[model samples]
Target: MLSRAARPALRAGASLQTRAVLPSSANFATLREIEGRLKSIKNIEKITNTMKIVASTKLNRAQRAMQDSRVYGKTSNGVFESAETKPVEAENKKKLVVVCSSDKGLCGGIHSGLSRYIRREALENPNFDLVILGEKAKSQLQRTNAKDIVLSFAGVGKDIPTFADAQAIADQIVLLPNEYSHIEIVYNKFINATSYEPAVVEAFSEEAIAASANFSAFEVDEELLSNLREYALANSLYWALTEGHACEISARRNAMDNASKNAGEMINKYQILFNRTRQAVITGELVEIITGATASEDM
Candidate 1:
């Protein structure tokens, strides 16, 4: 028989059991929430998959174009490389830093790598002026103390970069007087559809203004070279954007996967507690029935 004090305790225990089960509803809620999240993720997956396919397709073509053009860039370098005098003709020495990065965010290290390049170069040497491409690089470089920056461009929105853009940039840098004439482009060259390396800001040419302004001479017989340079830079730019998207997709996928696993564990834990609560109630009812029968028989 349950004493008066014990009865109160038993009632309290039952109340506690009900309270424990309260959170069990969260299991269903979790299932529902996951379903919604899964739907959204599915949509995002479709978008990412589509982008991946497009980037890879373009990457293949761009890679081939860049490879073909590299031979010409080598030839051009060979002609100028042998020059005995320093080609950067500026009476005063100045460096032009070209910043390349994605306009969009979510790509893992694409922007981060570019920023590091600027910090190491610009912050390391306050002598050079920066030329920023893409919104990320431009926004980041503003925080630096570099001086005499002549040209800064932003908003090269999507892939499929054109020669016009590169030409515009090349033209601007070449126009800088001899003092600020030497130029380097900081960009992530696309290695594969999935991966891109750090920003490479290689000096394109140190040719004085005469050679710098010769677009016609550079492209006269080397149509293929021009095409290659165009795509190579594009490939570098395009690759960074694509790889960034891939990184973001992978991160989100991993996070969602973990959420699903945790939900499953929680559901299992609650089920165990619920089962134990039910068993305890059954045992208590059995004890009361048996004790009441004994009391009546004794009377």
Candidate 2:
């Protein structure tokens, strides 16, 4: 038989106990959520780190391939330079644009840069057709310039591009029914590890080569000119592919490195938050326990 005043105090203490217990349950749930977030961020860091390592390993080989291909391409195109070759521009002459990009992503904006270049060019000259290399560029251009795409290649840039691959692609281009007056290859030109730009390498037709200002200086066999033109196209394609591959690798390494750094920072932030939350929860538990003990003793 408690007095009315004592009953009110007991009810108040019981209400405090209930509120304290509820918060502990909520605290546990919050702690679990923080732990899950921390684990997810850690996993992301691991993936980005692994990607950075792989890109770093591939960069050296890709650079070597690009250098060799560049030299080969220069040598192949020297004859055109010496002859001062120029593309024949006729009203009815068709132009072909070949875009060299990669199949993989996570390489930053390399692919998008190429697509944007082509789109800008298309806006200026809608008469030209496109030949896309790699899925990334193809997928992007398909949305805007689908009608202009005459040919496309996939499974490119998986490794260092081989001369044979270029030859095969050239063969397909040559087999097309329409004879293009000029063939332009668009590729990412690596200026530095972190910088690249879309560039074009021109491949002239035999007619254009024959019309060169200095064509009379060299006595080229009439039959061999066609073969020379084809060989030069292949060389140019190889150069573009190799250079683009190197750029892609470098861009991927940089992207992954940045991702890893950001993930690390996030992990640190989350870790601090988790520790503080845990401490706060512990402190709350301690306060609740002390309050319960004091309440019981007073009773």
For lDDT, the strongest prediction is 2
Overall lDDT per candidate, in order of appearance? 0.53, 0.93
Error of 1 at 254 (Å): 14
| Candidate 2 accuracy as TM-score | 0.94
Clashing residue pairs found in predicted model 1:
90-178, 107-244
- Cα displacement (Å) at residue 86, model 1: 2.4
Candidate 1 lDDT score at position 23: 45
Question: On residues 90-147, what C-alpha lDDT tens digit does candidate 1 reach at each position?
Answer: 5467676666655766455566677776787755666777766677666666666335
Query: What tens digits encode model 2's per-residue C-alpha lDDT throughout 32-110?
Result: 9999999999999999999999999999999999999999789878978999999998999889999999899999999
Looking at candidate 2, the ten consecutive residues that score lowest on lDDT are: 15-24
Per-model root-mean-square deviation over C-alphas: 8.5, 2.1
